[model samples]
Target chain A: MPPETPQPQATVRDVTQILTRTRGLVDPVLRRAVQQLHPHIGEMAGFALGWRELDGTSRVGQNGKGLRPAIVLLAARASGARPEAAVDGAVAIELVHTFSLVHDDIMDGDERRRHRDTVWKAYGVGPAVLTGDTLLALAMDTLAQAGTPQAAAALRRLSSTLLELVRGQAEDVAFESRPWSCPDAVTVEEYQAMAAGKTGALLACAAAVGALLGGGSPSATAAMSRLGRHLGLAFQAVDDLLGIWGDPEVTGKPVFSDLRSGKKTLPIVAALASGGDGASRLASLLGARPDDVTLRRAAGLVRELGGLAYTRERAELHLHEALRLLEAPELERTAAGELAALARFVVDRAH
Target chain B: MPPETPQPQATVRDVTQILTRTRGLVDPVLRRAVQQLHPHIGEMAGFALGWRELDGTSRVGQNGKGLRPAIVLLAARASGARPEAAVDGAVAIELVHTFSLVHDDIMDGDERRRHRDTVWKAYGVGPAVLTGDTLLALAMDTLAQAGTPQAAAALRRLSSTLLELVRGQAEDVAFESRPWSCPDAVTVEEYQAMAAGKTGALLACAAAVGALLGGGSPSATAAMSRLGRHLGLAFQAVDDLLGIWGDPEVTGKPVFSDLRSGKKTLPIVAALASGGDGASRLASLLGARPDDVTLRRAAGLVRELGGLAYTRERAELHLHEALRLLEAPELERTAAGELAALARFVVDRAH
Candidate 1:
């Protein structure tokens, strides 16, 4: 018989507790790694991580939510591996995540992140690129120092995943330059592939590396990898949903920011693929530079065409797939319980 | 007694033969690694490596000289390790070299390299950045697959070297924006440090990784690493000298390119630090943007102030130190002979 679904109410509380506890363990490890970078670039890295201001003032409580590293730890624990054994893997994954963020901000011309000036804005583009490069190198160094027999395999997995992440980033950039109204504009499958590379691949590597470092069997680690991939898709789907519909206060972005920038996110891709009057109207509203009024109208049209509902359903489906993958027999029951809870938290989180 | 310095006549011939033979082996390994990247990015990578044109035409005879990988293999052999066993490490170093080239082209806004359009110019900046990142990830992956017990150590050394390279690059960028006439402007010592990080660190890592992967003892690897560093310093010093005095036809750069661009290379730093009338005149000739006439005058003043001779002396000193390091007892006599020859070649090469 299929495993029973996790209780939504209990899962919510458990996920919050689990993330808080995991973040407490992982953040210090990340800080230490960043500190080990060469002093000048380390300062830029510290700023990128929100550990310091551009003027070199120390700061706190402004970092990312530590979602990727938390996934690594949870996946490791769920595979019956010791959480401590996977600390390096967790830190490595987080570093890679931040590296991507720094580069992505530059590529997208994003001025702010976490309500602070992006690295490229604070320091010039050259330093910002070097900062990202430094973090990536440091991440590999951290993984190598894990001193586990599985370290080679972990490095291999992470490196390959990093390449996939770059592929996704390349495709995303290419897509942005393409004419959105063209008949051959990015299709749903192509969009999914890009998302998988950009988001799913790194998340998958995080889980897989965690499992390997934790001493999980190969088959078990593979399952964790799959679980992470689906979870990433779900996470990205929700992120796309919120990009248009999320409250500005919560997201720390302007109203309809994605629409204003003409981002071809999952929800927008789905709306464009809906094939009806609303899709045509939405297409008309987007251009080289869409004004606020048109962006508002496009958002309304996307909603009117059931794009919001479709995206929400897509996120749920992926979350279900991730949870189902967590049912592998190799996973410890308690850790699996936490995994399910984390999966729920991913899609359910408002931000 | 100190080992007899090979006659300059014999050394030049031996160095040519060694490099030509080593390149035949190393180039194939590098090509295979680049081919193994995801096809889309592999194309960009191939273009960056000068293996193919932007239109996907298979190009030939346009790649780098494979100096770094040759050092890797020769260092491996010098430590009494089989050169074949260190192929992956050699390829990894070469990949890192190309990664730096790709990114540095973007940072410097260099439109052409090897008499062809740079990756950033041929593709967009975003793709160029991703292309560099992809090569870096692939390099780490290649190292991890070496399957040697020392793979972890190799990964750590290479990652650290990569970070140092970025630090050097960051400093180079910062130094460019600083006024050359400032009292605290880049000193000779600071220039050397930047050169060590930018060029010496990677070459050192190449030799160290080669030694480790080739199963050499710790002392042998350390000696080879030191040799590589001094050799790199010699190489960069020569390159800086060429940036001003070398023929444009040979260097693939414009006449008085470094001086025209107001680059703070080693010779420029030396001329500035001369602390006299010639230095002042040279300083007056340089500005935020120098014209052809001023750049020509500045180059003449720099030479008149002994900057060219001073830089050439620095290159020879480093080359001497590199050969002295080759006296390590762990190094095989025949291989050390080849290495010494290579050291002489580095400083003596015209372009």
Candidate 2:
């Protein structure tokens, strides 16, 4: 990652058009790849991707931001290849992102996502497991079938990214078992490592795969991987903010959702690590089974202890580093500018 | 597959020596690859592979036959490469097999496997899901990191096989929602297709990957894949028999298990398709959840309707074809003989 330059945040460009265009190019390939699944699996996968309703009818609703695929496309274009050249990579990355979401929902026992019942909630656990597996299988197959020696590099990137993803998830789950405060509590550094793996790896994979397929030099691909990693951390830090303070109507999650579940996300971890009076009060409250009022108080304490500001600062730091990487001379100038816009758009989601 | 030679089934060779040798070579490679997982995940995966007890102590028990890895190594040798040359492929194939078993156990809600608690039962569902995912990631990475162009071919095979494996599992689950008897019943052909996918694809992958990695020609790899698929179908047929009539002590399952669960195995499907009085009784008995005695009678009805003979014949047909494929001029002589012995041993598991 480029050295962080703690400058004033830029007035972000609107990336909505870029995201929409990327989705237009990527979803058809993704849908066609999904069609290779058994019809039963295909139906469940379609539903998970927000393409269909529970009854298998076409659905038009709020969907994922398609952030990863957009990065893939932009990274490919930044390597001077037409975005079409990396659509398969974009599709593969999107499938993996969806795969992780479905599986994570089951693990977290959450019933809702994007304002809808989760896959397990709608279809039952067994079917949901198969659906998640199908998406992942399709993800791996997409690259393997894409074409040769370049596909090999992409596969290597994808497989290693998968390991990092599971490791991060395993660590995050491990954190939940630790004490809410004191020596055993999750540290800021611990949270960063976990976030990097859980959130950063797939993004890194997306960029690396895209650049590789778009015929980027090895050096350029490595740089994009680092860029994506930084961007992912920025993305995750912003999400930590929303988990605590964002509107339920907009975020599709309950206020202080992280607190209710005792998730060791960055904000809470940072707040608890401050060793302040608010930290002690918040810790005690969390130690007990807090009600909604108690949860509200806990959220206030986290903010009061500087967690909100601390998390925002980290997000900015990483975002600047990511934007710096996008300025490398080897990258195509226009696409790199678009990628910068996308990075800022991701961080801006918290507001 | 070669034309079925319906001459008398030869006395099956003892393949214990070949299997034991293969296990010795493959386990070390598999264990080393599994070490790449996060410690938390590695321990759970350790438990899943029967390498350690739930408490993490080393264990010794009746283990899986190591059937798939054995075929991988032997197929490599048949391609005239040293068995050592394909250990990575063997390890990759074995990991995929373990991954499938762990996930399938969860999907099937099976509590015990090989007289031990299933991974989901020992660990919680969330941890088991992660463990299974970890194993799969390791499997893909093992192939990706193995070498160059050969690794690419193995990856392509592995990814496609993964799709088939999931398809088979999805279809098998779909079958449970299907009626026991109807014009809409799961036909013999449907059952065969499902079995081929659920059981055959991985074995086919194992042999093809082994041969490709060991420098086999494309035609030789294809021949080995077909042979392994036939062997896998034969293996599934034998397992169906054990599901109904094998001793509980030997099989680790109750007698008449398939009848109790109304699994549409080859025997029951064929028997029902006969449209005889026995078939009617068997179908009606299956519609209800049969008790021990009723399950016994249902098993008897299936036998009386020629279900047992039909399934045995199918197994024999596949096993013979698999063995005949071993006679192809491309394969080395001794390794081919050992592969034939292994095929017979897999089918002989019912006895």
Indicate which candidate wins on TM-score: 2
What is candidate 1's lDDT per residue for A298-349, written digit by digit as tens? 8888888777888899899998999888887778888888878888888987
TM-score of each: 0.92, 0.96
Worst 10 residues of 1 chain A by lDDT: A177-186
C-alpha lDDT (0 to 100) for residue B60 of candidate 2: 71
In terms of docking quality, how is candidate 1 classified?
medium
Q: Give lDDT: candidate 2, residue A351.
A: 68
B149, model 2: CA deviation in Å?
A: 1.1
For residues B29-66, what per-residue lDDT tens digits would candidate 2 score against the true structure? 88887787788899998888888988778987457878
Off by over 4 Å in 1: A1-16, A179-183, A276-278, A287-289, A328-330, B1-17, B38-40, B177-183, B327-330
Residues A1-351 of candidate 2: C-alpha lDDT, one tens digit per residue: 997754323424347778789989998888888887889888888888998988777986456888899999899999999999888889989999999999999898888888889999999888888898889999999999876677778888998899999999999889879998888899999899999999999888899988988889999999999999999999999999998898899878887888887787888889999996888898998887968999998899899988999999999999999999988988999899888888888888886
RMSD of 1: 4.0
